[model samples]
Structure formats: C-alpha cells, structure tokens
Target: MADRPVPVKDLKLLDIKLGQLPGWLASRNYSPMGFVNGYRRGYNRFYSKYIDVKKGGIGGIAMLLTGYVLISYIWNYDHIKHERWRRYH
Candidate 1:
C-alpha cells in the first residue's frame, strides 16, 4: 500500500462534506419507532428469503420465537442468578 498526497482543494472539499453530516441528520425527522420499524423491515426481508411460507409459516415463526427466547434467557440469566442468590443469602 502506498500513501498518496491529497490536494489541499480536495481535502477542504472532504472536510466540508463531513461537516454537513450533523446538520443533514438533524434536518431529517427521525424517531425511535422509525428506527425500530426500519430494523423490523430489514429483519423480515432477510428472514423471508430463508423461510418458505409454502412449506408452513409456523416453522418460520417458531424459529424466530425460539431464537428470541434463547437470546433473552442468556442475556438475563446472570442478572436473574444474582437476584436469586441475593434473596437466598
């Protein structure tokens, strides 16, 4: 890999573009629900590709539900154990 000298003009242009990011994001209306909706849309799109409704919708729902249950259990297991131990002690 070789380092190339960037022209001052190009550097200044890049700086100006980067500086506009915050203002651009602020100008657009974004909400927490919007973010959630976007995530759900993306997840559904990706999941749909691997899931076949013709075979059965239950299979897809079951997979997603089981994944959610396992992840939630693993994530909270430590906290739950801590609370239980505290109560016992």
Candidate 2:
C-alpha cells in the first residue's frame, strides 16, 4: 500500500521556541559556497525540466522560441508603430 501524505498542520514553521532559533538558523547554510551550490542545484533542475533537449525535446525548444518572439514583438510594439507612422507621414 502507498504511504499517506503528511498533513500541513503537523508541520510547524513558526511554532519553534526561542531556544531553537539559533540552532535552526545555524543549520541553514548562509555562506558563499552554500549560495553557489544552491544556484548550481537550481540550474540543473531548471535545465533538466525545460532546457535539456533529450529531456524536454522539440516541444520545449519550440515553446521557448515562440515565447521569445512574442516578448520581443510586445517590447518593440510602440517603436514599430512609431516607425510605421513616420513612414506614412
């Protein structure tokens, strides 16, 4: 049988005592190395999910390209309109 999911009420984020605050803060890595490692882990996850050709395949590439084109058009829409207006005047 599959294991049941834990209820959210069972987890306490703000219910910790003042005495545990120091230990809890210390346990979370706040160093530069920690930042670099965290960035790499996040990047790897993003690449695997959206950028890797073998994993995301052609659909991901097409989506990314289409999104880029759409954003570019939206960003330059005002300038394009101005240029067209100037050409007619």
Q: Evaluated with lDDT, which candidate comes out highest?
A: 2
> Counting only residues 3 or more apart in sequence or on different chains, how many pairs clash (N, Cα, C under 3 Å) in candidate 1?
0
Clashing pairs in 2: none
Q: Encode model 1's per-residue lDDT on 1-89: one tens digit a residue.
A: 89996543334224546766565455433689878876887687757765755565566778788999999999999998988777543
After superposition, which runs of candidate 1 have C-alpha atoms over 4 Å from their true positions? 1-46, 49-52
Highest-scoring model, TM-score? 2
Task: Compose the digit string of candidate 2's lDDT tens values, residues 1-89.
Answer: 99896443342447656776666566656799989987897668666888875545676668768989999999999999998877543
Give the worst 10-residue stretch by lDDT in candidate 1.
7-16
> Would you give me the overall lDDT of model 2?
0.72
**RMSD values, in order shown:** 10.5, 8.8
TM-score for each model: 0.38, 0.41
